[model samples]
Target: MNAHDPIRRCILLGERAPRESLIRLALSPDGAVFPDVRAKAPGRGAWIGVTRAELESAIAKGKLKAALARAFKTGPIAIPDDLPDMIAAALERAVLDRLGLEARTGNLLTGAEKIEAAARSGKLHLLLHAADAGTDGNRKLDQAWRVGKDEEGSDLRGLALPVPRTILAVALGRQNVVHIGLTERDAARRVSETLTRWLHFIGSHPALPTCETVSQGASALQIIPTGAGNSVADDDTCEELE
Candidate 1:
């Protein structure tokens, strides 16, 4: 765990972990259970330090309901039967929202040329590739990032986001967005953390084979391709690429 990530206790596992590593569940006044992917919801929240599969297993065995009841110290709370799907949707929205915010704030660079230029300049803190991005395109940008440097004077290693091109293009309000490079570490960290949580929530990370490996059949690539999901519709809040 990084020293910066706050430590929180998982009510179910009773283990201490980074706050960002745990999923937060909030309780409504009516005793409804809500997954707080951003951890921004109000009221007392319970933390869980389990992966998506573990969470689903717990829910299936009726263990999660008991754990939540214990954590909230209340009578049986209403947990939606489709709680996993709901949480997955919430996580997707949070990631897209963060991407949109980053684009609006000029902290994100899209398009192959712009992103590759930034990567080569050693100004890029993170590199995101759409799940459907062609292997050639991904390779070029990954090479640029390999030759780049971080702000701390260390070699930069590019990390691929699990989001698809459709979602990425919609989120950034750009046409055919296949690549994104984050210029600031803080912004990159925020996006990475959110993406990691989403991937974990969906049971995609550290378990399933990445899209890159499946597509290229080459172990040389460093990208971990994300699994497919429903597309997020475009919104007026996203600014068009200039």
Candidate 2:
């Protein structure tokens, strides 16, 4: 964890974790619960580090309601039936917004040729592919990234997002955004932070095979490539680029 990331305890799990890694649920004056993804909302808030499935289970079992009551010290906290969907939507919006911001700043590069050149020249800080991207194209770019990072024999590869090319293109205001590369370190880190949090909340699935968000550091960011059904640990400590 970064030294600056404040630690907060999850009301549902009672486990302490970095605030950035957790989602904050703000309590309204009318006793309603809503997701505060950016954590910018004012007033009393409770943090949760559990995944959507876990959260739904807690809600069904009345565990989340009891925890909220204890945390807020209030009565009749109204838990919405669609709280899980709301949280997922909020997280997805956050990720898309981050990408759009980066695109506007000219930190993102598109087109297979451009990304391949950046990767081969070691200028790419992060690489991403749309969910429906072709396997051959993905492998080609993955090879380029490895060559640039001097890890030709290793398993370092670009992340595959859950969304398709159409969604990514719309978010970045581009055409056919099948692949994307971040040229700046800070831009990559910022995108990765939001992406990681979103991914962690949704939890890994077979659709997101061999994918992960970038890690913050002086060197190139590292993402652990895994096969389908493999899982990445839910932690903020991004692995070094060595």
lDDT of each: 0.67, 0.77
lDDT of 2 by residue, 46-102 (tens): 878888888999999999998888777776899999999999999999999999999
Per-residue CA lDDT of model 1 for 39-115, tens digit only, reads 77775678776766778899889888887776677766999888888888888898889999999999999989998
Top model number, TM-score:
2
TM-score of each: 0.77, 0.84
lDDT of 1 at 180: 84
Error of 2 at 119 (Å): 0.2
Candidate 2: the clashing residue pairs are: none
lDDT of 2 at 78: 97
Candidate 2 lDDT: 0.77
> Once superposed on the true structure, which residue ranges of model 1 sit more than 4 Å away at CA?
1-5, 150-160, 206-242
